[model samples]
Target: MRVGAHVSISSSKATSDSVTPPHENIANAVFRQKEVGGNCGQIFTHSPQVWKHQEITDEDAATFREETEAELDGPWVIHSSYLVNLCTPKDGLREKSIDSMQKEVDAAARLGVEYVNVHLGAHTGAGVEQGLENAASALDELDVPDGVTVLVESDAGSGTKLGGDFEHLATVIEKADLDIDVCLDTAHAFAAGYDLSTAEGVDDTVAAFDDEIGLEHLKCVHLNDSKHECGTNKDEHAHIGEGYIGEDGMNAFVNHPDLAEVPLVLETPNEAEKGFEWDIARVKELREN
Candidate 1:
């Protein structure tokens, strides 16, 4: 399994930030992974700011692939910007959202990234049903280049978010074409009230995902621990094995029969004085056990 974190890729190399051009970022991430003892990872292709547009040239995309392959030593995945919310109410904003999503789609295709994961977005006071429809419409309107597919990530279900449960994600995928997929976030699933820590709970959750969202569509997994309790409906990420998910829950996820074959990325908090040493060790232990 590919296990790593959401690394930052900054535009400026002089700064200590993790943000770099896609190629440099991947190369750097590989180094960071080795430094922190990670075997696999994921990163955002561009700056996540939705308000600020990012431009990618053909030479940049090509060089990025070349450098990443030459420098990094792990399977890599790309995350779309956080600003994209397909469930928006305003028509103009919806158009911009679609445009932005397509840009990422295009970039992913050019870079040959296997998956482009996206959040289903909060409805912003709009009805959940409407938000789902809007999301479906936006996805249907997008033109994804060949060899790249979009994965809708499950959220914490706070407020008008559409992907808190299997049913909501199923509805969106059902309405859209078959190419779309889903990425289950363990923390969000737990905060959304799915008890994934227990054997029975993990089985039930996987069963529901299979029956409702189609297990075939599950392309990725976000291995995060929730800072909130079950049913909290909040989005707070904690270091692995240190929060509400606990060591047992993480073990359950790592050893999950269904998730065993899929790639798992850590979006865990790893920047404190302690660094990601503990988090990496926890995942390694689980994988070994």
Candidate 2:
């Protein structure tokens, strides 16, 4: 399985030298992935809290693509800004979300990344049907490059947030005119009432996902353990094998044949002396030959 962490692209040096440009210094993500023993991973184009994206110079883009090709077994993904609410009912927020997403997809193309992952966000009083329509229409606005595909991530189902149910995911894909895919976050799925705490639970959840959304559309897995119990709707991520989706569940999920070819990205907490390096090592241990 291809697995890695969501790493920072910020550079250690303030300014660029001979090889790389300042704005597009994401080449650092590649080095960081290798240092942590990851073969593939994810990165933010800018501070996800704010709606801004750093520009990627062509020179820097070339270096990033070349380095990634040479060093990693990659299909890197760029996670969109947190403020983007594709399901928003308000016009101002909806426009902002669309603009932000457009930039994210453009950046993904510039960086040679294959996927751009984002949440469907909250419906914010719009009915589920309208919210899904809003999301699908908003996605249709992007001029996605030929090789890039947008992925709607499963949410924790808190408040009015969409993407909590497998039906929501299937709905958006069906409604959207674009060729999109799904990124299943284990923690979020468990929190959203899909039991992933045992081998049987994992099996059931996989079957459910395959049924609701085709297995072919499962492009990636946000491989995380939940801090909360199944159906809690909480979004906290725990280290692999240590959270509510304990060792038994995690072991079963990783080695499951249906998921063997899907890439796993770690969004687990980096605190408590168990960072991505430790998490990546743990995943390697979990996978059986």
Candidate 3:
């Protein structure tokens, strides 16, 4: 059961660490993930709110690679900024999105991370085909390093956002000239109307994904529980087992054989009572040894 959380890679030690530190700069994510009992995880290079970029010194990047190889069981994924909207029809925004993705892929190379995760953003009235074309072409602009692969993530399907339907993911992969993959966020899929609340639903959803877009492309799972009901198009994440995709759904998800080898990187909420540590522990408890 390879499971972890999205730990902060904030240069500020306090924001990055949940445990006491003998920490080294941005490499603190490895320490933070270990302390939270996660063997695989995700990180944001800088704050995702604005368009700013962050730097990683060669020394720190080397240390991060060394410690992660020695400590973690799964690959690291860098989540791109929220402001990146590849599906946008606007010219300026599309350029910004491409540049942002380029930075993310480059950073993933420097950090020795395997995947760079991003949303397709919204179409904003470009319609589905044009939006998908925009996203694929935007991704085509990047000179992604050899080892790192950009993973287009599933969306919550709110408004004009793409990637809710499995076909949307397949379409981008087909259209993009660059080699890419998928990261299925469980809560987002649920909000997008793919049932995952029961054993049958989980099985059906996996089958649908396999049919629409081969399972071989599923590189990661954002193992989260949804705060909203199925098909609500809401994207709030709940503590594992405490929301609409409750204990049964979570248990089924963690133990599902089709997803057994895929790393589970949680983006669950940090509540007063339960956070990453608690959720990671819950996942361990759910999986059969």
Candidate 4:
């Protein structure tokens, strides 16, 4: 059960602990993960909304690595900036995306993080073939460090977005010169019309993914329940078992032998005072042996 939430690394968000100077730095994420009863998790180096990248002091990076190694079962992932569009055909946007990803991977190496998660982004009328080519070429430009791997995440199939289909994921991996992997977002996959709302649907979707992209390339699972119906293409996430992918579907997905060892990171929304702690507990409960 390598499960955790996408915890914040910002020092501004104080921890729930009574200790003074709580949530001091990025290392605070280690404490935050424990607070929510999570063993592994994800974080953003800075605000994903902005283009500015935060510089991590060597001390901060070392402390984060040391504490995480000592306190938690870790394979921490750095989620890249939301603005990065590796699929964009526009020259300016593509260059910025490459630059942003380069900094993120460098940051990952510094922090001893194992993976950098990112979306393939919208094709924006460039069409699927061109967008995939653009993404592959863009990834080829990155000099990813020895320990870190970039994971292209699945997307909610909206407008001209890519990575929603299993074929899209397979294509990117096939076309890219640099070795890469994937992070399958449950909510996004559901929105993209991969039915995950029933036991049968779960089997079919898993088989489809294996057939198209190969399960070996799936390094992570963003386990979330979708707010909308199976094919709605909506990206909102609900609590673990309360949304369309309800108790039965979730139980089947979590207990499936093929996914037993894959890390599950919750991107579920908070409501009624229920947050990561509640969601993590729910996931553990749903997962039988």
Predictions in order: lDDT: 0.78, 0.91, 0.91, 0.91
Model 4 worst lDDT window (10 residues): 14-23
Candidate 1 global lDDT: 0.78
Residue 269 of model 1, lDDT score: 82
Query: What TM-score do all the candidates reach, one by one?
Result: 0.89, 0.95, 0.96, 0.97
On a 0 to 1 TM-score scale, where does candidate 3 land against the true structure?
Answer: 0.96
TM-score of 2: 0.95
Deviation in Å, model 3, residue 235 alpha carbon: 0.4
TM-score of 4: 0.97
**Cα deviation of 164, candidate 4, in Å:** 0.7
* TM-score, cand. 1 vs. native: 0.89
- The worst-scoring run of ten residues by lDDT in candidate 2 lies at 13-22
Model 1 agreement with the true structure over 109-145: per-residue lDDT tens digits: 7776767788889889888888998899899998888
lDDT of 2 by residue, 1-289 (tens): 6999998888763222343323447798887788778999999988999987778888878888999999899889999999999999999999999999999889888889999999999988898999999999999988998899999999999999999999999999999899999999999999999999898999999999999999999999999999999999999999999999999999999999899999999999876456888999999999952
The predictions' CA RMSDs to the true structure, in order, are 2.9, 3.3, 1.6, 1.3
User: Runs in model 1 with CA error above 4 Å?
Assistant: 11-27, 70-75
